[model samples]
Structure formats: C-alpha cells, structure tokens
Target: MPLQAHVVAPSRTAHVLEIIKGAILSGDLAAGSPLVETDLALQLGVSKTPVREALKTLEGTGLVVIRPYLGATVREMSYEDAAAVYDMRLLLEPEAVRRTVAAGGRLSAAERALERAREADGGVARSAANREFHRALYEGCGNPLLVASLDGLRDQTSLVSVAAWARRASWETEAAEHEEILGAAREGRADEAADLVRRHVAAFLDRLPKQDIDPAPPSP
Candidate 1:
C-alpha cells in the first residue's frame, strides 16, 4: 500500500521552520532530542526536503545542531551559554530601546503586545507574548542588522526562559516589567527605557537554574 503524499505549501521551508522552532520553544521537542527529517516531515504533513532545509536554517540560528554523522538535534543551552546570551542582550537591547525612543517610533504595537502578555496564561503563551513585546520595542530601532541579531538571540534563549518560568512562577512580575518599560518608551524617556530593559533582562538572568551551568555537547 502506498502512503498518501502531503501537499506542500509555497512557503514550505518557512512553514517547516516555524513548526520545528515552535515545538522547540514550547518544549514539545525537548533539548537534545533528535530531529529526524523523516519523522518531522511526517508529523508536519510536509516533504522531507523542506524539513531538511529548515533544519539547516535552524542550525544557523543556534537553535538546532547538525553533526556530520549524528544528524540534527535541538541545542541544549547551558548556564554559561545562557549567561553569555543575556550578557550580549544587556549590551544590545538597551541600545535598541534608546534608538527606538530617539526615533520616536510608534509604540502602539508594543502596548498591544503587553496587553496580550498580561492577558495570556502563564507558560508558553505568556512567554511568546513576552517575546513579542520585546520585539515590538526593539524592531523599531531602525537597524535591520541589530533587529535580526536580536531575533536570533531571542529564539536561542527561549529554552532558558521556558525553564525559568517552570521554576519560578514570576509571569506577573515579568508582565509588570514590560508595562514599565513600555510606559517609559511611550513617554520618550530613552534613558529610562534603556535602563528598564537592562534591568528586566538582568532579572531574568538571575532566575536561571544554577545547575544548568555545565555545557553538554549534543550526542553525535
């Protein structure tokens, strides 16, 4: 008996990428779990070519690792890795906030994202909304390169955020931080916005598990 072929969308590669990335971010695909192209293709109702391409693209974003012989697996973010990612964000995000404020970028998008975050239940929904709030703020920085860089960094750090959320029921606190940051940006207080974002990211770093410090290479 022949298995029926699934219809491929015009943006098949991108579709596959989002599906796989969402699975990883939501922890449906755990860290270090093998990403078999055949299985993913079957599960996503797409062909293996798009799945293969999506894996390659995800690898570039540091979300998935592809070894020569071992194949693809979700990347495990170590404590050291998380610290470094947060450190880089501290350096970049504040500047992004400042730039957005200086340019007087429309802040309504950020406000909406904040509302979504506030309304969402804790866990993946809230975390996703939190990410959108940050993106809405920084994407207005008027620097495509910086925005692209931060987007990649955000995807890579989602695992850390999910793990942190599980350990500390701090969604309310995080929602409050986003509100304050949005208020500062809306008021055109570039310095205040910058400072708030800096503090917000730093607070998240403080919540990460200490035991995750050890770096573990993906099994090959």
Candidate 2:
C-alpha cells in the first residue's frame, strides 16, 4: 500500500488575528506588552509569518504598535487618548443615531446585540456585545466613512480593556441607557435618539476612573 499524504489547509490569517485580538481584548495580553512573533506563533500553533501578518493588521486597528526598531507591542491607551476617543464619540454618535432614526432603520441587529449584552456575564463577552450594539445602531446611518471612523474609535477603546472596566463597574445603568436609546430609535424619534446617545456617551466618560498609564513589561 502506498503511503497517504496529509492535506494541509491554507494559511488562516484571520484565525490568527482573531486569536490575538481575543487575547488582547480578554486582557491576557496587557497594553504595552511586547508581541514576539516566535512566541506568539508557538502559542497560536501557527508559523511566524501568520503572526507577523496578524500583528500588522492589528496595528492598522490601533491595537498594536510596530516601532521602527523595537518591533510590535500592544498599544497603551493613555487617559488623554481615551478622553479624545470619548470626545470624538460624543461629536459623531449623536448625528449617527439621528440619521439612523430618520432613515427608519430596522433595529433588529441592535436589539439582538443589546439582548446579548443583557444576558452576558461581565467580561470580554459583555464588552464585545456592547460594541456590537453600538455598531448595529449606527451601521444604517447611510455614511460608510462615518461608520468606519466610529469603528476605529471603538476598536481603540477596546484595546484599553473595556472588559476590565465592565467587570469593575456597575453595568446596570449602561443597560438601562441602551434600552432608552434603542426605544427612541425604534420609535423614529430622531432628536430624542440623538440626545439620548449624546448623554449616554457623556455619562460613560464621567464614570470612567482616572488612572495613569502603566506600561507592560517587554516579553522575554
């Protein structure tokens, strides 16, 4: 009998990206932690090439930084960076919500995401669901550029360990606020939806604890 050759699946760059992203979002990889390709490749059960590519993709999303000589490391979300992200959200989200309501957009996806958030226990799952809820709300805004910008801000904020914050903070208020915003949008109350979104974001920023950036140690 002839020996059978095993078939290998093609490179899974997306899979690698997701694993690394999950690690970062789950707080397994802290901010400023060095991303050594060899270590990551071994940990992920893939080659260094895939890990390198994934890191580059993560860099584009502002989750990883590739310095000229220092290689890749998780990006730190300083207080200033977080404040700027919140400010941008405050400026853009209101209009996005208003536009979505004016267009009579369906809230099915947003509703599902909100439900997921409500059901999820605190941590990465809840944080992810919360992000999905916001994404779904603004996705029908009829402006791809605006949506993309908001997505980038959301990703950057995630890198700041929003899940960790969720674990520590009381999320009941956030859920209630989301329900009110969703109701306003579903009822086609454009101005009210917009105002509610603005207030929701502002309140979140107000509740965030002030903290200095503590950079992670480099990987050995």
For each candidate, what is the lDDT? 0.82, 0.80
TM for every model, in the order presented, reads: 0.89, 0.89
Positional deviation of residue 125's Cα in model 1 after best superposition, in angstroms: 1.9
Model 2 misplaced stretches (Cα beyond 4 Å): 1-8, 161-167, 212-220
- Return the clash pairs for model 1, or none: none
* Top TM-score prediction, candidate number: 1
Error of 1 at 7 (Å): 5.8
Model 1 lDDT at residue 90: 94
RMSD of each: 4.0, 5.8
Cα shift from native, residue 70, model 2 (Å): 0.8
- Put down candidate 1 lDDT per residue, 44-163, tens digits, no spaces: 788789999999999998889999989999898888788988998998999998999989998888888788877876577777878888988999899999998899887766777886
For residues 76-126, write the lDDT of model 2, one tens digit per residue: 877677778889999898999799889998899999999899888756787
lDDT of 2 at 144: 98
